[model samples]
Target: MTLQPTLPARVEKDRTTPPRSGPSRRRDSRYEALTGYLFVAPAVVLFLVMGLYTVGYGFTLSFAKWNGFAPNWEWVGLDNYKDLLWRDPVYAPRVRHAAANTIWVMVAAPVLTVVVSFPLAVLLNQVKRFQGVLRSVYFLPYVTSGVAVFFAWQYILQPDGAINSLLSGLGLGSLQQPQGWLGNPSTAMPTMIMITVWGHVPVAMLLYLTGLQGIDRSILEASELDGAGWWRTNMSVVWPLVRPITAIVLLLNLREALQGFQTFLVMTNGGPGDHTNVLGLEAYRLAFLKNLSPTLGLASALGWLLFAAALVLALINLRALRSKT
Candidate 1:
């Protein structure tokens, strides 16, 4: 090598020095961090104001007696909770009946909805044409106003309504006979359960459809190549893959069933008796609708009780379902 050109000492020193990201780069990084914080600030403020503040206030209110209009709050300590839980005859009965009805709906609605939705989702996934239209039709109830949907179903389930008429036309004359589906205490809860299942199926189906789309086509093909039939492949391969989605669907359904109020309010008003009463409706009645003893404190306490139950149930459900997976 022609004697390597003698490198200038200044050039060599320059080459050896690491580049400094001086004050400007640091300033730019600080600017980026500030922008990120600015972007998140509104959401943080909203949660603090609307979510945390309201929850805190509600918790505090639960221990005090205040008719929402009262200028002063009277501390009752655990009296409100005790009354709802055991002491007050009127409040306790309502709570027990409502809690039982709520449990029934919570158990039945999710099971029935999943039973119906899974097959519909499978069929929809197989359809190659007009799939979007079909999906929209199925999903319409989910996007519709809940009050409107309940009103529509209220009409359909009436004694002389479309369901009865259809049953009559199908020669199920005994079943079509006047039954007062929403008015009769014996039939009201079951009718509500059916409507709840129908309303919830579309959402569960949509979730299942998404899960189905994410399944590996190659695995399905390999299952078929291995002489696995449709039912077998679905039961063995597809079901396992979608277990997480099932868990989500179950949690959502349970939450909705537990907190359901509007449908009962509109359709049956909890009843010919407290037949369709639920904890959410009971809380509302205690807080706002009772002509006698409108106890906001008790209502708040009941609300917190329901919240605790929901939280515990949700955790149990997640644990049970996830552990299976």
Candidate 2:
């Protein structure tokens, strides 16, 4: 038998394969980098122009006095900050009141929303029928126009409105007769809190539902095999796994509650006695609603204040909710 010479593997592979030289690899890497830059260019430009520039301009404006239609701004150093923090009597009370209201809503709304929505999400997750319809129904308000929803709630909360009428029909006439929810100073903030909770619950529910769906089925099965009840399994197995989602939901809810303006704007207009005024609405009132001269500087200061508060709270939330593992 004649022995055939063994062919080299490199030669055999080279017949069917193209070699990737150093220059080719470098060129490919350059091409990928270019494509990435092209993809992100618009977003970067937008952030610079609409986000960074706007924020920087606003911060600068916080240091200068401008009446919104002025040809020139009078640079006042930290005078704007001083007035807001300690000096101006007329504006100082409003700032404190608005800050208090904002903090109340920020604390209450997120807690209530999570408490109410998490169960709804779990229930919806277990449902084998019409889950889409139920989810859409719950999520409708989130997608609806803010102005429209606020107005709708305004009507609903009026003294002779649907809620009061229902209370009266159910023999809770004493509760109905004393206060016009949106019109009363005492009840207005709580009513706003309720409306906020209602509007925001759906979003939390959706997020929780998504988190629930992403949980490992094997872990759930193992928990069940260990004879864990629904509440027990969720507490021990599910909660820790979905802590990140909870953190996200908490942070988002806190941010939205802190920055909310429209609901108060339409429902109460910070009214009855600045009872429902929040930081965002107070900022707007300072900027545009003052008849004598717009306090654009003060408004800008309030905006920055709100930003700072949100940032601090976000950090706190992150630290609090961070998973130990």
Candidate 3:
């Protein structure tokens, strides 16, 4: 038996060993490249890490009753969420008010921007001298800080802010009077919306300008040859071409409006009352302002709900764009 086994030891070993080839080696290299690409995917990697930390932590915190810095906390299940939804009177309406304000901002910012900016862009485009300078000057507010910004605007809107100052010069009503530009409920939302629009119009103008530059001169010439007036050309030619840019500008404005905490925090702090409250400001109050005990659960739930709404809106926009295309 030993002799029979020893007859072809090399052959037996060769039969037992696995085989390797050029194609196999090449396949192995490709496999490695695939994994390497995944490792280096900046966006995917960043999303995973950031999402895991933010979304996961937020979700976890929602179920626990944690104070600002205290390590001692208890599992509260859906209690916080229930409290925000129905049980707690203060937080419930605050969320509703905040949502309404956010919607106003979202609608007002971009629409007002389009109304104010399109003409400005056209005017600026036509100008030969200091055009770029004017555009830059207008765009300054987009890059400005919210902290000092609100104060300036507050003064202007103040019983004696800029608007008041001009009004007083013109012998109009005083801004410093108890008219409640910010303090009163009726004007608060509108005031915030105007602020939102004023701050964002520059961005809309810039994007519209960029899109306008991309319009073919030949197309405009052709439209003019077809007896199209300025309005006709805009509706039939320029507007259609600039649709994508408009959508993008609107999307940006919507995001900003939905995240409308800065305006609330700086100027109104969600109001002299809850007049300017939006979900964003309410979330802030629940999470940070109210107590050492955070309403993380409700905040997270509200955040997810808002995110879902935004996603739906975005999808709707995308689908509409696709249909147009």
* Winning model by lDDT: 1
Name the candidate, 2 or 3, with the larger lDDT value. Answer: 2
Stretch of 10 with least lDDT, candidate 2: 8-17
Which candidate order results from sorting by lDDT in descending order?
A: 1, 2, 3
For all predicted structures, in order, the TM-scores are 0.88, 0.86, 0.81
Worst 10 residues of 1 by lDDT: 11-20
lDDT of each: 0.88, 0.87, 0.78
Estimate the TM-score for candidate 1.
0.88
Judging by TM-score against the true structure, name the best candidate.
1
Candidate 1 colliding pairs: none
TM-score of 3: 0.81
Model 3 lDDT per residue over 1-325, tens place = 3554446545444556577799998999999999989888987779888987788888777777766577666788887767666777977766766777777778877788788888778777778899889989999998888678888888777664566566668877644346547766778788888888888888899988888888889999999999999889887898889888888888877877776577778888877677777877777777777576555567776776677778988998899889889
Residue 246 displacement in candidate 1 (angstroms): 0.9
Give the alpha carbon lDDT tens digit for every residue of 1-325 in model 1.
5787886666434546566579977998899999999999999999999999999999999999888876889999998898888898978878988989999999999989888988899899999999999999999988999888888888888888998889889998777637567876777888899888888999899999999999989999999999999899888998888888888888888999988688888998888778899999989988898654538889899999989988998899878986886
